[model samples]
Target: MKNVYITRIAKFLPNEPVENEEMEEKLGIINGKASKARRIILRNNQIKTRYYALDKEGNVTHNNAQLVAKAVEGLCDDTFNKSEIELLSCGTSSPDQILPSHAAMVHGFLKSGNLEVNSPSGACCAGMNALKYGYMAVKSDQVKNAVCTGSERTSSWMKSDIFEDEVAHLEAVEQQPILAFNKEFLRWMLSDGAGAVLLESEPNGKTPLKIEWMEGYSYAFELETCMYAGGEKLEDGNLKPWSEYPADVWGKMSLFAMKQDVKLLSENILKKGVASMKLAMEKHNITEDDIEYYLPHISSYYFKENLYKEIENQGLHMPWEKWFLNLQKVGNVGAGSIYLMLEELINSGKLKKGDRIFLQVPESARFAYSYAYLTVV
Candidate 1:
């Protein structure tokens, strides 16, 4: 197989950065009261700033597809223009619509040219899925180059209006003013951003990151849903999607709002992530010693120590200095998180030739993970 190189990396962050204190002002307070989980989540996540695709009046500035189109536009240069693209693979947890795939919307926005496009939908690992698809497409000689993107318009879903009916129902019935922690906490955790990279058979820059190997794993066979949107978890541990329920009750139950099983996530996320990494390492016949820069896409800094403990227990312990993360600066952009981190690291002028960058992407949506090895050359 031919090697796939990540040539040009770019990101599109809409509007100015929103501080921790300014979140509720833009997202609005749920139940007309401040979220009890916001402060704690912000403190633990250590995210000082994040971007939103909405204005102060809570109006959308860019849709998910537009965000991706903007990011893809940033990839164009004298060396590679939009017309030169042969494949466009996009991934997102939040799409503007469900019918036309995310990639089609992106292509429509770009008006770059008619090309093969795909959209992989999920949580964090969706971005890796998009990258892997493009990587394989180039490596298999199906195309000379491919453009892959990951983006999220999460702010639209996190706005308080989405939960008004559910919060109002709770206030009317339970007399409690606070929204559910599962849904409310995410409002503080997610942000909006889009990132893109041009993958080619040859390196475009002096220090292009070459994809060595990519692997994805799913523990969904053993674990139930840990995080979800547009659905409800039934008593039997199965999800009831938004379409299954009545249209009127969707707002009442906040069926379209994102939710998580916090306890389940804490118990299984790190444990399963490292366990699956071990399996991937075995298959690749590589060890931690083979990597120089470790980039793990984590939603919160609170999980940093816990994740390290899990790896240490498995004898795959990596020193903190080897770890690189920007969650504190970018918050969590879900599927786009890793792409933003990679864009920053690659443009940071830190990586040199022959460096090995290892990516660990874990999605709590259902305990799926994606790992990739990239070598700077």
Candidate 2:
């Protein structure tokens, strides 16, 4: 089997950092109720806050594609020139416009010199999907080097009207805005950032991280249960969250979405991947004990808890403290989470040559991707 290796990885966040307390204050939640509620949620998730890009005026910035291109340029630098790159894939949720594709803009900015480019817009797994595609292209010898980038600028999507109304709702009840915050209705944890990774075909006479194999499985549930972009109309004239009228009045959509994806992964991806890994380990006369690092997608604090439990149930021992705790600082960068974590590990000297690493990705779109790599040995 041919080997595809990661040559470089880099991540960039805006200079401004926002804490939960500051957000509450900005939202006019003066009472202690909001602060208390935020405390409870933060305590449970071990995330105090997240970062976002801000303009010179100290307002949340709204340039998603531009920042992403800048980050990719920084990663490419002297190591790999634009002409050397055969493919450029960008994974992002926040696009300036729906037309022409964000990838086109990024490609133009990088001056990729006619390199093939693809821009994918999945909810949170966009980054991982981009990486997976790049791996396939290189493994198939369609490209010698590929660049995958994950970038998000949620501030662009911020609905100031909705925010004001939500805050008003809390004020009416004499409670803090945090007290009125609902996980299902409001997404307070998401922030803004961009990350990039460079992948190159292994060079002769030089050892590189071996990409053993990868598999992806997706299952779609009813549209009413988990609407990605559109939904039914609501009684009021105002459009639903994403410009569509709201339907499914019960608001159990997110719950159903989570259940469907979890079920699909548990049945189709995890069971088979775990079994295959076991078989491959035995075929190579290796054991779980031989693995040194594990990287899994970090979506939420609750997600990490459930994932860790599953890992334990599978009898896999991991260095949770070193390998899994980085999410606190970065939050979730969508598909770039695992790759960013790997970069951190390598830079910190925790990931060494010959170490075995497993990467598991669970996307919000009811898809799961798994990949295994053995450090250059």
Candidate 3:
């Protein structure tokens, strides 16, 4: 079978690292019960430092387009002809605007000519879909080469001052003091980064990895309301206008206002994720012995142990030593996580020729999953 090769990968971090303590101070949860909850979440998540598009005072320094442009630029060097780029696929959980597609904006920024552009607009897992689309386009002879990018400025969401006050109000109203949408919770969890890959139908002498097979599955859209941003849905599944929004709904109506049911995500993730992985493995006749590296894009540290156990239940017992995780350094970068993680592995220079890598990514827009098999070349 003709294979799609990853000729090059480039990732860009917005700025300096933002430590947990610094985030705490910025969120004004320095030392209290709220701080304690923040600490526990961080400790369990295992993230140390994450980059943000922010300045020293915790203000957004870069917009989504700017961050994505930087990564796309990195992917293109003197040897890479921007003209030969036949397709561009851009994915993001947070786009700069809703009018012009993010892919179009990126195309405008890079001045990449009138090639087909696809914007897989949805949750974080959209990244994998964008990449798969590019790969398929090349493998099917629709294009000679394609550039796929996943970028997010989740920190852009953090710039809102409403969350801090809203949390306080929610806590005060409840019978017991409870944290709700607290900055400390998300400040340590989300991040800013962009990653891009140039794919080709034939090896360019710069190819580092060859995608053997990629599969994706979607289930649980019935629960799509569990995690959403930008708008509120009415009882009949129609979006309510901003003017008609109720107080509860109005409070959550910012550019990056995300309302999520953490409990729902935790309960359903493993079952759905494992099912998706098992199907991909069975289809490809893959097993633990065939895989050298297990690269998974998990949303949180809380799910790590359970995910391992679920995979074990499937009778594939790959040790943690083989698992590659980068959430500790970059947090969950939404659409950018998978590419960022893969870029880290590639840059580590640890992969040997012919090593098999298995990638798993699950998105939380009510659960979509992507699994890919790649071999180091």
Candidate 2 lDDT, tens digit per residue, 273-319? 34444454555565556667767665557566565555566765555
RMSD of each: 1.1, 6.2, 3.4
Write the residue-wise lDDT of candidate 1 on 1-377 in tens digits. Answer: 78899988999999999999899999987756777788988888899999999998889999999999999999998877899999999999998888899999999998988799999999999999999999999999999999999889999898889888987888779777567788877888999999999999988775688999999999999999999998999989999999899898999899989898999999999999999999988898887788888999999999999999999998886888889999888879999999999999988889988999999999999899999999999
Candidate 1 accuracy as TM-score: 0.98
Q: Write down the TM-score of every candidate.
A: 0.98, 0.74, 0.88
Ranking by lDDT: 1, 3, 2
| Residue 328 CA displacement from its true place in model 2, Å | 0.9
TM-score for predicted model 2 compared with the true structure: 0.74
Off by over 4 Å in 1: 174-177
Q: After superposition, how far is residue 33 of candidate 2 from its true place, in Å?
A: 9.9
RMSD of 1: 1.1
Q: Write down the lDDT of every candidate, Cα atoms only.
A: 0.91, 0.59, 0.78
- Give stretches of model 3 more than 4 Å off: 25-36, 164-185, 221-224, 232-249, 252-256
Task: Please give the lDDT score for candidate 2.
Answer: 0.59
